[model samples]
Target: MVTMTVSHKRKDALKDVWDAVSSGWGSVTSGGVWSNAETEQEFEARLQRWENSGLAHEEAKRLGQKPPRAPRGWHKRQYPEIKRGDKAKYGVIGWARAVEVTRGANGWHVHIHAVLVLEGRQQAHERAYALGRSMHVRWNKGIAKRGFTSSKEHGLRVDVSEGAERQLAEYLAKAGEPEKAVRNSVEKAGKALAREATLGQHKIAKRGGRTPFQI
Candidate 1:
């Protein structure tokens, strides 16, 4: 079964939860990470925009006016053609994401772990790689517009793999779990196996930093 937990901190999390539910049987999958350097002010401003959008929606509804259309988020705005079932474009049938935040020596670090389900077809690997590179380039440009910067090497990452639906599901499930719960579950599974299983399950932070759960 494709099991998972949901976090309401970001709207993207809910979308990811839906993707997990609807695309459990998908074949080829691609995983990605998008990150950038941000100061505390920039991070807070980002949160403010989310809050403002939500407030505007609520206010309009309460006033008996039609709620405004939600703004296309950064990812969608960057690639307006990423519609589900659009084979001519990216063939992105399903998408899921988990946003992680933690403080470190540099500052507050925020990044996204995303899983994309691709249509089953010939040359899936080539298609997946092309999409990843495109996302990386667009991501850099998008952040630049916001006055933030990211390194070419670490700003973005995308990896495509076939027949890993279950593994991807488990990774998303763990992303939303509390640190203590995940730790306990791993311990129950036995340290040796858990260590090996999680080796590539999530990305390690640069410079020996800890993930949200590890901190």
Candidate 2:
């Protein structure tokens, strides 16, 4: 654990970060439940639970099949390629940084990670807020689409920062894990022979590509 020594000052800073994330997600949808970005008033009402384990156990359970894990911490990162994908011939936008796809009852929830470069730290924050409005800009008549909101009561979060070089490196390294979940599990099982006990069964072939007589 990082110990997360959060002072009131740190809390305020992180709140700004979270607001940026929520607003950006909302803007992508354009508006409504799909772009359900929480406002200042909403946070004022629910900050207690926000400081707590996200929501109560019931809500967290609803988000995950088993007990939900702690919410993933957000960070800003840099990628020379992601920032200049066009020149690299990869066909990606500079503003787009990361994305997360998750399974749920309805379907997969696709979360985007965008890191737009701004002038400075203050400008970075200002742009972060502005991005929130864009979350709903995609809605019909500038209305939001679905598959975004957490529920009626809460909204998702967006985090933005200036010069995310370190953050981007970490996200990229870990990104492979979730993307290859199924493939990884199958590979792991094939490599290990789990032990089982029965009354008579004892010595056996290594299963390490061994012939019966080799034992």
The TM-scores of all predictions, comma-separated, are 0.39, 0.26
Worst 10 residues of 1 by lDDT: 1-10
Model 1: residue 19 alpha-carbon error in angstroms = 24
Model 2 misplaced regions, further than 4 Å: 1-93, 139-156, 162-215
The residue-level lDDT of candidate 1 at 129 comes to 68
For model 2, how many clashes?
26
**Displacement of the residue 68 alpha carbon in candidate 2, Å:** 64
Instruction: Return the lDDT, model 1, position 167.
Output: 39
Provide the lDDT at 189 for model 2: 39
CA shift of 5, model 2, Å? 30
Worst 10-residue lDDT window, candidate 2: 1-10
Tens-place lDDT digits, model 2, residues 40-59 = 56655554443354444446
TM-score of 2: 0.26
